[model samples]
Target: EPEVTQTPSHQVTQMGQEVILRCVPISNHLYFYWYRQILGQKVEFLVSFYNNEISEKSEIFDDQFSVERPDGSNFTLKIRSTKLEDSAMYFCASSEWTGELFFGEGSRLTVL
Candidate 1:
């Protein structure tokens, strides 16, 4: 079965540099989302994009973050300025909301 793929499964970056996490979702999905889970917190939605516009976003998706669908198969999250607290498991998920979710293994971001 085809699934989402994220590069660097793990990334370590400095506290003030920009970092972009990449993902390739299932071929047929039209909706794309970014979510993160801090050490002991619940999964939180960052943003959702479709039809080339942001459908919705949570408070955590502040000015420091942005997302893009650069081509037919890639979705990317860019953080303009990293923070130590930015460390977490970034999950890329896709579904038509039929109550099922397919998630990427996750890209672990560790900022220092």
Candidate 2:
């Protein structure tokens, strides 16, 4: 049973600081995505990647954010600058063609 794995399960950073969240999706999955949940809000989609290119992105994924597959198995999301409102639980998910998404435990980002 393979699953998505994320790093830095919990991170505390100052406002305007930079943060990078890492994830490793299931080896056989083709599509990957970065989604976030602000404290008590609904899950929001940030970006999606497939075939080594960005497939789609939400408005919430502004210029401050970037996604990359630096290597074959590692997918990452980098926030150029953190804001107080940026605090949320970022989840990394993957699926074999947009069917069922397997998600990681999520990396919690807390900005002060």
Best by lDDT: 2
On TM-score, the leading prediction is 2
Candidate 2: list runs displaced more than 4 Å: none
Backbone clashes counted, model 2: 0
Task: Record all residue pairs in model 1 with backbone atoms less than 3 Å apart, i.e. clashing.
Answer: none
Per-structure clash totals for the candidates: 0, 0
Question: What is candidate 2's CA lDDT for residue 64?
Answer: 97
3-85 in candidate 1: lDDT tens per residue?
98887799999999999999998888888889999989999999987877788999999999999999878989999999999
The sequence of per-residue lDDT tens digits that candidate 2 reaches over residues 1-112 is 8889999999999999999999999999999999999999999999999999999999999999999999989999999999999999999999998878999999999999
Candidate 1 TM-score, true structure as reference: 0.94
* TM-score versus the correct structure, for each prediction: 0.94, 0.98
Where is the poorest 10-residue window by lDDT in model 2? 94-103
